[model samples]
Target: MLRFDDLQLFVRTAETGSLSAAARLLEISPAVASAALKRLEVQLDVRLFARSTRSLRLTAQGELFLEYARLALQNLEDGRQLLAGSKAGISGLLQLSAPSDFGRNTLLPWLDEFQQAHPQLHLRLLLGDRVSDLFREPVDIALRYGAPEDSSLVALPVAASNRRVLCAAPEYLARHGQPQSLSDLARHNCLLYMLGGRVHERWRFFDGKRELSQSVSGDRLSDDADVVRRWAVAGVGLVYKSWLDVAGDVRAGRLKVLLPEWRGEPTPLNLICAHRAQLSTPVNLLREFVQARCAELLAHAPWNA
Candidate 1:
């Protein structure tokens, strides 16, 4: 039943030793101050002040209440300050999900560097090909390829220009002749990967005029994209994968681009969250950090050369 304004007025009046003086300090009129003091006293059922026309003073009861009232206001202010500082500081658990190949091959070290830059930040990474449901899971952010199908989720571009590349190891190429044309892919062993319970055997490429579709098959196939990349790197078969995923291999001479004249499928990367509100300071920083790293790596892509 006690109001906060009345309590504040009581404390301010006790500090100033005059109701009218406290009213002026609080920018309130004399009548309102008197009413607030009366309300406080009535709620507490005790006389808070002994007033003379010339002066005002707190009763013993009022003196006791003043200490608790001051503590309450101070505690409220401290809570507000703590909340503001927490929002400004990037120091919390950031749970993220990303593709298997990119996570193992690239994101691990990038995140390590990112965490080093923010020593207070904690990370929980869930790396796999399976998509994390942001709305229903503990994940705070998800790194995904292609534009988001859900309009409700917020997607921030990390590598919008990134795309898949057809590549094979030199050892594999030495045994299986390199495909000279898109049509020749049928004759070569193309490492296949499964996504969403289906094999991604159909490879699409674009020349200047039209798209070239080729149905590829190989002796190897796996649901994990990282395995498919590894298969290509081990001279098992040719693999069509993201340029970012194969960039390091190409640079190390472990893999070589098969067809330079054709453009592979687009695999733009983005950071997705359930909603715009989830884009906190750490999430935004992660997005920017990954974006910069991807740009730095993609800059060295063999085809880019």
Candidate 2:
């Protein structure tokens, strides 16, 4: 018979790509973990991993088994928690990743409120412009700006109504004059956000049934999105950014929305995870909370008027 511990070890090893690392995480000796895996393989009559000196990879059978194993373990854990009254409370370290600008400007306060409500729950947040690989990273979840392009991810829609908006400071327009049309944007200085070594200078928009992407240029670019927004506020250049990221600036009269008749491309927000099994009670609660907050913010947005 296969032990439950063996199932856990197998999953962790597959996730971490090393048995020793999984053993350390489980607080067990590597030898014991090795024996447990051997026992499991003997019972199942299938090799779960193909091991090399420097790496370990799941076999085809192991890949298939891993999905079921994760589902089984999650179900068992859910049942245990419910029986133990742990389901009534949210307590655990939730490792999360998010884009830097939204994480700092928007999510920080929301996270504080969440923490206040669930004091027992701990959070480890990583902020970056790059997408986090959930299978490889130690993150339980990630807040992404766009839809999950990878089919392997399970994306829960948090802000479907979110869209990008093009804006420039009044000072910039005063000095450079306002762009009269889409063609006019090319003549203006555009601020750019850099991601993965590429400057996102191609601005997309929707005019009625037609979609358009214009190649924009700027005198300055930064990997940090907040810096790009700051540059736009200082009248340095025009910027295309998420409405949520610039809503406050727009309201404060620091930035004025341009091309109001034309719509910027939609960039819906998603709460993404590796597996649906990872959506425990607290995760689900957080998802709902974020979705509601985003809706509230958009509802009161000055640009919406």
Scored by TM-score, the top model is 2
TM-score of each: 0.71, 0.83
Model 1: runs farther than 4 Å from truth?
1-89
The local distance difference test score of model 1 is 0.82
What digit string (tens of lDDT, one per residue) describes model 1 on residues 1-305?
77778876886677667888779867999999999988888888999888888878777887687768766654554454457576445576677999999999989999999888887778989988877776434466899887777888888899998989999999988997888998888899889998777999999998768988899998998989999999899999889999988888988899999888788988899999865655666777788889999999878764566
Question: Residue 148 of candidate 2: its Cα lDDT?
Answer: 70
Query: Least lDDT summed over 10 consecutive residues: which range in candidate 2?
Result: 79-88
Clash number for each model: 0, 0
Report how far residue 200 has shifted in candidate 2, in Å: 2.9
Model 2 stretches astray by more than 4 angstroms: 20-43, 84-88, 170-174, 194-199, 207-209, 222-227, 233-235, 252-254
RMSD of 2: 3.1
Candidate 1 minimal-lDDT segment of 10 residues = 73-82
Candidate 2 is scored at a TM of 0.83
User: What C-alpha lDDT do the candidate models reach, one value each?
Assistant: 0.82, 0.86
